[model samples]
Target: MTAPTREPANPRFHKEIVSFTRRGGRLTERQQDAWDDLASTYVLDIPRHTSSTSVDPEFQLDLTETFGREASTIMEIGSGRGEALVHAAHENPDINFLGLEVYIPGVAQALVTMRHLGVTNIRFAIVDAAAALATMLPAASLDELRIWFPDPWHKKRHHKRRLITDDFVPLAARVVKPNGVWRLATDWQEYADQMHEVLLSATGFEYSGVWDERFDDRPITRFEGKGIAAGREIRDLSARRINP
Candidate 1:
C-alpha cells in the first residue's frame, strides 16, 4: 500500500484520470437534457467560497480540537442530495466533512438541508469528485471516504464511464491516511464485480471484505431503497489504506 513515489506530470492528469467516454453512455436523452439544464443552474462560484479565508459561522468547533483525537476530516465523493453527508455529520458531530457533487440543484439542495438540520460541520462543492480529489484535497488528509450508488453505466460499451477504475484508485489512496477506510456501494451486480477487480488491483489499497449484510455504520441510502424496490442486490466493498 505504499504511495506512488511520484504523480503524473501532465496537466491533464486530473481530467485523464476521471474522464469517461460520453458516446453510448447509459444516460438517457431525458437524463442528459435534465443534467444539462440543471448543471447550468449552479450560480455559486465553488472555488471562490472554498478557497476564501473566511470560515462559515456555522462551524461550532475547530475539527482537530472537537474530535479530541485530532484527526477526523472526511470527504464524500458524489454526494447527491446531501442526505448521507447531512446525516453522517449530524450523527457524528466531531468530524468535518466536505461533499463533492456536480449537479447544481443537488448542491443547492444539500446546502439547504445542512442549514435546516442545523449542522455546522459540513461544506460542499459542485465539481467532479475525481478532479477535485487530485487538486483540492490535501495529501493524506482524509480519514474516511465513501462513494455510494454512483452511476452504474450498465452497458458493456459504456463501462469506461464508471468511476471506480484503475486510473483513479491511486489518487484516492494518496489522499487517505494510513489505515483509513474507503467504502463503495452499488446495486448493479456486474458493476460491483468490476469495482472489486479494479480496487483489488490498485496499488495502495488492501481490500478488507465484501459484505452481503450491511455493516453497523453504513446507512441504507435512498438510492439503495430504490434498488431494493427493484429487487436488485445491494453490494458493498470495504478497503483500507495500508501505507501512509
Candidate 2:
C-alpha cells in the first residue's frame, strides 16, 4: 500500500488543515451547570493561539503541577462525551488521563459525567489536539495517546483535515515515551486504511497492523454503537514508539 501523504503546510491553509470544526451548539442546562461549576476544577488552561507556528512556553501545562504527582499519563484526542476517558480514569486510578476536545458541549458533557462519577484522575482541555501534541506536551511525556472515532472527513478534499496525517505522526512520536502506544479507531474504511499507511511509513513507530478488536480499556461509545447499527465496521490501529 502506498503511504498516505499530506500537503505541505502553507500559511494560507494552516487553519484549514485543522482536524475539527469549531461547533456552536447550545449546552443543555445540566451541561451549562457543569461548565459553570466544574470547569475551573477540571478544564486545562491552554495558551491562546498567536500563530500556528509557535506556542508560548508559559502556556505549556506543567505535568507535575497539573496532576499533583507523577503518574503514567494517557491523553485522548477528541474525547467527545468522555465515555472512554471517564471509564478509563475511573477504572485506573493510578493513571492520569487528559482529554482534548474542541467542541464546547462535548467538553462540558465530559466534565458533568466525570463529576457525577466522582472521577478525579481526569481533566479536559478545549484545544486543538494536533497543536497540543506539537507544542503543549513535553518530549517523552506521554505514556499513551488515544484517538477514537475522529471525524472521517470522507470527502476527498477534506481528507487533509483528518487528525492522522504525515506530519502528526512525528509530533506524536516526539511526545510519546519510547514503547508508548498510540491507539486509534475509526468506523470509516478509507480513513482506517489511510491511518495504517501513514503510520507504517512514519519513523519511530512500529505498526502492529489492525488490532483484532477494540481496546480492552475503551468502552463502546454511543457513536460507535450507532456506527455498528449502520453496519459500519470499526477498525483499530495500534503502534508503539520504538526510537528514543
Candidate 3:
C-alpha cells in the first residue's frame, strides 16, 4: 500500500489535535483515572476511544449490556468539537447520544462545553468512526448515526480516506436498526457526489430526501463556516438503513 499524501490546507479547517500515542505523550495518573472513572460511571452509554481491554473489565459493556437498554441511542461519528452533540442533547433530553471524535483537543473543548451547559445526556470517545462500527457496536443497536462535514480530503490520492466510502457504509448499516437514519453533510461538491453514489450503491441502505437550511436548521460548524467564507455550497444527504 502507498502512503496517504498529507495536504496542508487551512489549519483551522482541519483539527489541531494530536494523537494520544504520540511521542512525549504525557498524562498524569489522576487524569488517566478520571478518564477511566468517567467512562465507567457514566450511566448513559458512551463509546471509548482507547482499547477497553487495558482497562478494568467492570467498566466495559458487552453486546447484551449495550443493546439491552431501551433508550433511543444515537452515535454521531466524527463528532468534531461536539457542538451538534451538545446542542442535540440539550434540545432533546429524551435521547441518549454517543459521540466519537479522534481528536483530544476537540474532545476537551467539547467536554468544557458540556460542563458549562450542564448537558448530561451525551457521552464521548476519541476513536475513528470507520473502525469503531465493526468493533464497538453490535448489530442493529443504534437508532441514528450522524457524520457531518467530514474531511473532504480534496486531493485525488486521499479520496480513500473519506468516511462515506463503500467499506464504511455497510458497517454503518450493520450497526443501525432498520429505518435508522444516517445523516451526512459535506461542503465539497465532488465529495458530496461521491457520498451520494457510494451510499446509494451500498446494500441495506436507501437514500432519503435531500435537505437544505430551510429543512434542517443546524448550526454552522467550524469547518462549514470556513467553507461558507470561501463561497462554497453545503449539501446534506439523509439515508436510512432499510435492512438490518
Error of 3 at 79 (Å): 1.0
Tens digits of per-residue lDDT for model 3, 188-232: 999988888887687888775345342253678798888899999
Error of 2 at 74 (Å): 0.2
Best by TM-score: 2
Measured against the true structure, the TM-scores of the candidates, in listed sequence, are 0.72, 0.90, 0.74
Specify the poorest-scoring 10-residue window by lDDT in model 3. 16-25
Give lDDT for model 2. Answer: 0.81
Instruction: Give lDDT tens digits, candidate 1, residues 76-113.
Output: 88777777888888888888777776544455565566
Query: Considering lDDT, where higher is better, how would the candidates rank from best to worst?
Result: 2, 1, 3
Clashing pairs for model 1 are none
Off by over 4 Å in 2: 1-16, 51-58
Kindly report which residue stretches of model 1 are placed more than 4 angstroms away from their true locations once superposed. 1-71
Give the Cα error of residue 135 in candidate 2, in Å. Answer: 1.1
- Output the better candidate (1/2) by TM-score: 2
